[model samples]
Target: MSVPTPRSPAAAPAPTSAAHRTLWRWHFYAGLFVMPFLIVLAITGTIYCFQPQIEPLLYPGLLRVTPQGEPLSPQTLLERARAAAPAGAVATTYTMRNDPRASAEFIFRLPSGNSESLYLDPYSGAVLGSLSVEDRFMKQVRLLHRALLVGKPGELLMELAGCWTLVMIATGLAMWWPRLRESGVRAFAMRPASGRRGRWKEIHLMLGASLAIGALAFVLSGLPWTAFWGKQFKAITTAANLGRPGDAGAGHTHAPVREGNHAAHGDHRRHGGTMESLPLSEVPWATGLTAVPVGTSASAGHAPIGLDRVVAIAGSRGAGAGCQVALPGTPDAVYSVSCFPSDPKAERTLHIDPHSGNIVRDIRYDDYGPVAKAVSYGTSLHMGRYFGLANQIACAAISLGLMALAITGFVMWIKRKPANALGAPSRPSSPPPMRAWIAGLAVLGAIFPLMGVTMLLVWLIDRLVDRAAGVPSRPVRQ
Candidate 1:
């Protein structure tokens, strides 16, 4: 007797709900606004992820150097780079070479409030080239990622887009949840039987679901770097003592150090708990940490010792290889060396007193508090540093996948559009379940201030338009 194989069962039909209709309506609008900005972010972000492999190719003159003899003195490198600058230019900070064959960068400021960088041969102190802040391509890409190439105003717009993207994801998942349950294993099943539009829908949905985890990772990783709300998020995490750099569990003595320069010690009351005003997400994990003193107070002590002594201190502390010492700008500024970008766990941040070259603060990844540890690791993963090229490729793939989804979504919208009408989901019957909806999204609004403002604007306009037409909204047919 031949045994018969069991056949798979068909999926049940998904039931519709009032909440789903309301969510779908909002999700459509959110997607309409967010899709374009998301495209820009994905493109720029993909480019940035491959920057490690690309920068050398783009600006070899400013990045690479011939390794000859030992590098020149740190002081000499600074002087030569500044001297090569235009008259009245002043050098602020210079980066020590992490790679022996890499060019040194001396950051300078001009009278017009613009910043420039001078690249020099660390061995001979010869100027390689100078690049103005705005003219650099990578710098512009960075601005594009944070803002829409529009500076502060652009930043607000981008933040709004990011928040709306989150909304879109939330609503998309809501619509997908019931469908998944009803469709069973076939929830992930794709069929191209209905021609182009149907194929696009299945492809878009599946790709989006596949990319969900990575997409969320990128979004959350970026939040801590946002200008307004992101800064606040950092401050909150730090204030809660959750971001301190040190292993609290191991009972390490984390001596509190002075944070930033104050007019006097009394000024500490005003800025005591605040993180230092370091560039946003510029340094790997330097914000909200205590700043070490220069081994002498500004009023009573001698000038800080030269950079050579600090380099020696860093070398003694096992930060010699693949490390860079950032020059101190202010008289009382401490010298800091960053090492071990390859592995977040092996990372080290050593701050030295420029006055006596004393090691003031030495922090390692294991030394971070819980939140700090998460943020640190998340940042590395987000930047594609954790897994090298593979990480970059994965991020790039996610970006490309998002682009595909956006294109397919727009195409579907076009194919379904009524001649002159907006291609939105059918409006809800009666008033929306907005009371609960607002309460649920209140947290999102708080975290993203601009999103909160947008919600208010949307609610007002929605009400005004509904009342003027004086008609109950009808649900759309699938």
Candidate 2:
């Protein structure tokens, strides 16, 4: 819904100026562009927030198991899962749940380059079911939330939308600040007798102001997942030893000693690749750049330590149940075990030498750099995993609040717009002060290059349209 305008009583003390008009115009444009995508993100994100509760109901037989005395060894369960899977499906990772009733899950990569998860009864060694990795309902929702399920192009589009949403929030605050100044608490008051548009405006302003901080957190936390800005940000932060822990910054207890050809780089080489290169499922953001250490083949001629030994090794190193172990794929591959707990402080990752069943490298939450630590907690809070159900409710409320803002905004626009023309706010006689414009451009360019480029392009197009229409241009004042 529209913010309190210059003529509105809530903003009566403030005279309409170039800055006010300019901000309103930008607020309108940003909202218009971001509304649809915001709605989609809110819906999918809300649904995904409750995935822990929903998925169990959707796949009770596969996810849940009755603990019958001592459970089968991990190696036995892996073998049973492999036998039940499609022929030639190689087991890549095994996830051990802390809950006694939870079934063992094994991720398998089929010969056709597709991945699936097979759930087995931990006690009986019986296969319960299998699900296509990409086709799962929650996975599809996540895809839509991140990329609109259209892949890389959609990912880029969503990133742009997210960047513009920050602009929308900034301009919206500028538009609403006058009302807050003039009316104090009364500025947020709803006027039921003031008609439908007034009601929508009240709801929109109230929710928008209330949820702005949370919305910012969501956008900023989710930005780390974007295809373009995310990679650049990761690289930049990693290089600065702020986002991801480097060799000296990691503070890992046991750094793996490289042997053979890997010795040139010494212990814990920075491979400049993400954890995705390893067979990991749900990795922590802080360790995303932590390189996978290659194993020495000195003991490779001996029987390779089996999955059971790897699990025991991880447990001995404090990575107990709930850790997902990525089985070594080659002679030089080390078994990667990740314990991604709901509590960010307990997050840990370990690499075990498959040949000697020795801990190669061990990284805990403490090993992360300051920025990386902040991001780890931010991501957990963003996903509503930090404080349990209450956190979920809070996150869901914010998502629903965003949806309400979008819907109310649409209603306000529909009622205010003329049938014959675009309903955008009219431009001011003069642009915003030159210094303000320059400062804004600098901030956007430095923080969000994509938005800065597009913003300049939009400004150029507006200037061309003004020139074409013969509108006299007034110089921006200080």
Instruction: Pick the TM-score winner.
Output: 2
Give one digit per residue, the lDDT tens place, for model 1 in 209-319: 677677778788777767777767766776787775532123233533343332232221121111233221245563344443333445555465776667777766666
lDDT of each residue in 70-135, candidate 2, tens digit only: 988999888888889998999998997778999999999999998999999998898898999879
TM-score of each: 0.82, 0.89
Q: List the residue pairs that clash in candidate 2.
A: 1-409
Q: Positional deviation of 384 in candidate 2, in angstroms?
A: 0.3
Per-model CA lDDT versus the true structure: 0.69, 0.79
Can you give the lDDT of residue 129 in candidate 2? 86
RMSD of 1: 6.8
